[model samples]
Target: MKRKDYALEAKRFVDAAGGKENIESYLHCVTRLRLNVIDKTKVNEAEIKDSPLAKGINWTQNQLQIILGTGVVEAVYAEVQKIMEVSNASMDEKLDNSKLEDFKLQVKANKETLRNKSWFFGEIQKGMRVLGDIFVPIIPAIVAAGLAMGVSALLKQILNPSGEQLNSLLWIIVDIVTKTAFDSLAVLVCWSTVKRFGGNPVLGIIIGLMLVNPLLPNKGSIAAYNAQLDFYNNQLIEGLSKNEIYKAWVEAGLKWIGQAPTFDANGNVITNAVMGDPITAIKVWIIPITGYQGSVLPALIIGVAVAYLEKWIKIWMPKAVNIIFTPFLTITIAFLVALFIFGPILLMVEQGILIATKAILGIKYGFGTAIIAGVLQGIVITGCHQVLQGLEMQLVIDGSLPGANGAAATGSIFNAIWTASIISQGGAAMAIAVKAKDKSDKELGFSAAISTLFGITEPAIFGTNLPKIKPFIYASIGGFFGGLFAGILNVTCPGMGVTVIPGLLLYTGNWTKLLGIIGVNIISFGVAFLLTLFLFKDGIQSKKTKLGLKFEQLKNKIKLDKFKIKRKSAE
Candidate 1:
């Protein structure tokens, strides 16, 4: 639905959730506002779900997650906070107090029922929530930067070839805009992580900057240099010899990253294989000083450790000396430990994960990638999708490198997989909308379906498809088929973070890949739509309930009683 006033809608949600007093704390992710309430039963979920503003609602443990799509969720979250602040002074508040005793009784039964959920999965979900807290806040920034880079790449392709006057000037400006976010990604991660853990935001920013200081060797550059050297040294190129064909090409740009080796004890130059000949061993930095640029794991670990340490520092230190000593101790201790201890350990772990992911997704036939494509949405459903955040970001970082077009197209393949799954769920919702006999069901399904095309899928999943099990299964099948084709075609994108229709921008340089993802969209949507329409009867809805009428109808009953009292006096 097109929005009314956001503040008024926030009031509706707040009122439906018993009252402002029932809420304890709340936070928002990309497409949902997760609120922790003192009393779960006080939340009139039916009213909230039926609201024109809400796409759906679900609970993970005690936290109520309301899916409001992407653009609206943030606005509504802000308004809700505002509502909480002003609610006390408002004499006209419409909170219904009639359900108080019933709510208390229901709260007990709700607790007993909630305990049936698996304790193991609950703990795992809690960890995933922490990951969500760290990553989801920066999602908008990443998406914006990724799209900016997409535009820059398009500008470079179109204007660079023609030697237009605007080419270099425009490209330089856009390049600067695009590179800043990913170039300082570790800093963002640290900042988000510390904020998630309840530490001071300023300290988080300081620690993050320390992790990515300009004085240190550039991490991404060194990795690129090493990766190229390893590929040449291993002689893995089949049917073509790099010695004869690539020696000149290699010398064109690869000569400056390392230096000649020192002589060994016997006065012989240390040598290693290069291409067809042996050369003096490449002397690189022995004592590493590289800063993590596009890394997430190192910053994540350091953020957690420092957050707790800062809390500890405050426990015993005299408040008198705290002003002088706190900042000094935190910065110095975090800097040294990050460099010498946590940094190395976490980097090694990050390297292992990166290598393993590349090996699996980079398999010869794209079989491994195809499997990931088919099942990733299932992972999303489990709320374990947060676990893949590192993998997905690494893919985008690797795929955006200069030579990735000639590589296996890892980023694009993973993106296509993601896009396929997202849109398939949307297609299923669309099918339900199209075939529904009830007007309310059609409205619900249509709203959810349309949001998914913009790359938000939780509404379609939670509000429509998952409640109807067959549609969810059919959607996954559609994704599998679409992703299988995407894998075979080796579709490529410059980056990730956007998908479906808007995602088309990522492939603007290549017509064939663009057409290929278009094919993915059509196939995934078509299959899911066809299956859901033909097989599912009556479409997606509860038989008796009207989503948006519940709360309003309840309020109307109170108005009717007051009117009856007024009429008796008039008679």
Candidate 2:
């Protein structure tokens, strides 16, 4: 067999896709190289599909996706990016007036396509891709932290049972590893968000640091701080409430700004007349803005606003003064908006989602669990699964969701569903591998299925199950049952990030839950495999054709090698 040259293949891919100039932007998710091209008509879809390196091709959400297996996709993407940079540099050196006009025209066409009714959904899909790009870079650190926390929990159960204090260096190490990433999650999120939104990442870091400033009261201390503040001149105010404290702060602000508050008939300050309804509401919910340590949405919202504000400032200010003014105005505006408006609103939204999730997953007989598991893969296909990152992180930090019998479990129920869905995809891929008659098809299927065991299903989903519709359907059905079983057992995950094989560390202290998770995987795999084998016929026939071709190629290769040896001996 000939060794594959991924770099060469990547270059060919670039040319077939109408060169680097045609590419607007490109990104990869697990298994596929997703490219947004300036002109879809210019892309040679047939050439891309015919490439020996490409496992499959999919056109979805207004992006061209070329399926390359998990690890291979990353390598191909790097090579492609390198090629584009070299190509672009060369074009810049030889640039002329007509070429410059052409470049501008291409940019204009790209912008026009964004507003076209045909491409509206494509633009929305790009939003999801942007979200993925922001968080994907930070995932490794988060996953490592979660794993460390899980290990610490396990050590506590084994080494310090019954709450016996065993203060040791080992415990300190565990604590450091567990807290470092999670405690400063906002900082990481801010850096990534700002970079994605085309702003200075350092400004994003400054904003993130402010959100989680050491001087700010921690979330756990907010209540005590509020109560302490309720005292005026060291005299405790009787019947003091959070609302009253907030009102006092707002009134103090009014006075500082040289405005007098108007009172109503009951001697109460009319909040609407003083600062309007929206600002009043913001003030009331201000207590929740202490820190965004475990939050995602708030930092993202702030980063977006900062990016736009910085751009606007640069446009209006003189070049000589813009440097100083841009950073100053950008941070000032972003920080104030985050502190007073977006932060509180997003906090409430986060709380609401948490509350709603608990209610749904806490439903009788694990109905919610089944539904979430069943639809989760579909969500991933549509690129909406990134939304779960924040939810899963919050759930893991919260430790456990409400369950029956007042029993608090030690892991995330949401993660359990994710685990089931991921494993089911692997199972579906594996079944296709088993039923495949062609050597190439079997290899692709087996590789994709194996990749899923490590909690990466893009290879399995895009390379195998997606192409065979019935397998995907069967896998989803398997996921639902697996999730149902997990919910019934009240399975909990100790952390987020890694799922499936590596996720076992999260259940170190709870063997029963671990076994239940294993059972879920087995059941999901079994159901998906059986359903795909019995129901899908196209997969079987496709394999047979490919296998026969492979055999013929192998025979021809053997004959050629023999002929070469004979000729060499005669010479």
Candidate 3:
């Protein structure tokens, strides 16, 4: 029906149902009108159903539902709100959106206000979007780094038997490639975050590449290293601070000044009438003044100058602000936030988590590594996996954690859980495909398989397993056994991710140990699938619900007329 007719249709229904005063709280979910009644006697549900408004009548677990599909429910809800003089105490608190259009406009304006604040926040938002976009691709890159390094002896032989001719070039190339990939992971993560937020991906990539470029001399060390060698001192000091060259210049000047005593008044060498303290004053003081100018002092002066300039820019930028100026402001704010806020917060969080984990494991005698691993394994995976990534990157930068342990572990977990879920769900699907009688059960069986593969287990869990009792029992039993086995193996994870199986790659150097972990997961999945199949075969077959004799009498009348017509036509 057209929406124009809904108001009139709703008014008629409300009037028939005791002028809406009889209705108490009203809510809607999916297919039904959830209405709490003031007086059940006043509500003629049969008449309400017969009034050409509602689809059907049902009372389940205290909910008096008026079923209506699609547009009809919304139309009815709107009209009811307008004419129905609802009692405040009896009304549902959530049926308050009478002026939805106005509220929507207000919400939009508020969002715009926030967006207009500064360019910096916009950049942050952009970075977040970029990060979200590239989150998946980075996984493969991380895995490649690990694979290039030797997996344990079982997976890959690091020590080759043939000593005939070692390929030094290939070895060197691989080493360089892996090292470079591992070193710049952070820059990639940050750049991706920015790109996802709508900034240029190429720009972000450029920035990332620059941040970790090892070829670029570190600002602090170049000066010190160049000062020792004469050839390097001349060439490299040109690039270093003035202070670096000032000391060298100061010493040469002092040496010349010291010998000035022998020079005559007209710049000729006086020989006998030498100055009293030309060398002492030059050696002790004048050179040091020039030395300070050449070194850190100039850099410090420049930094102060730039900082004041930035402060002044901030003060003036807001007055001349426009849409174009917005990007510049946002970029500035984002840079500050990245350098100050995000960077420090990430570092501290990473350190805290690492410290806590180490402390847990470092306990003497009383603590079991496997038990600690099991307890923390899931907890850390939820949100704290980022912590491990941060720490691992920090370690790599510091020359501590080799390669990318954090990323590798994450991959292993993703592969492991993914494989186990697929196998288990596949088994359930096969069993249901063969044994289930009811159409709903058979359909649910297929859906369960699909959901499991995608990592959303709610429907499979709550709808099928928990309700059936047998599947739930088996799954819990399986989870417990798996947890126990995982605990016993002392499987240590330096990283975390989605899949359970591939996460075993975190222990790549210990291929035997990884296989042991994989074996345990398989056993868990196998036990759950086998037990569930054995217990639920009968349950699947006997799923029909017998309505009471009173309700059963109405079945023929409720059945669609098409079936009746077809039967009569056939006869």
Candidate 3's C-alpha lDDT?
0.41
The better candidate by TM-score, 1 or 2, is 1
lDDT of 1 by residue, 1-571 (tens): 3334888888888888767767766778767787767555467888898778788876644567778877889899988977776644463344444444444444544444334434554454455456656766775565466556655545543444321334367667876898788667678878888877767768888988987787665544555455445544443453335442233223222232333334579966565324332222122343234566665667777888778888889888899998788777887898888776655554455465555655767765656565666566765643234335445544554454334356644444677888888889989989988987545457667877776676766557655676556678788888877887788888766555567876776676789989989998998888889998887654213311331233236335443223221123544
Arrange candidates, best TM-score first: 1, 2, 3
Error of 3 at 119 (Å): 55
**lDDT score, residue 311, model 2?**
85
lDDT of candidates 1 onward, in order: 0.64, 0.65, 0.41
Tens digits of lDDT, candidate 2, 191-273: 87787776888999898888778765444233223222323212223443434433443322111111334578998866422
Best by lDDT: 2
| lDDT for each residue of candidate 3 in 463-483, tens digit (9 for 90 to 100) | 345334455556555544454
Worst 10 residues of 3 by lDDT: 288-297
CA RMSD (A), model 1: 12.3
Ranking by lDDT: 2, 1, 3
* Residue ranges of candidate 2 with Cα displaced over 4 Å: 1-121, 143-153, 163-167, 217-287, 354-362, 368-483, 486-571
Looking at candidate 2, what is the lDDT of residue 528?
Answer: 84
Model 1 residue 514 distance off true place after TM-score fit, in angstroms: 9.4
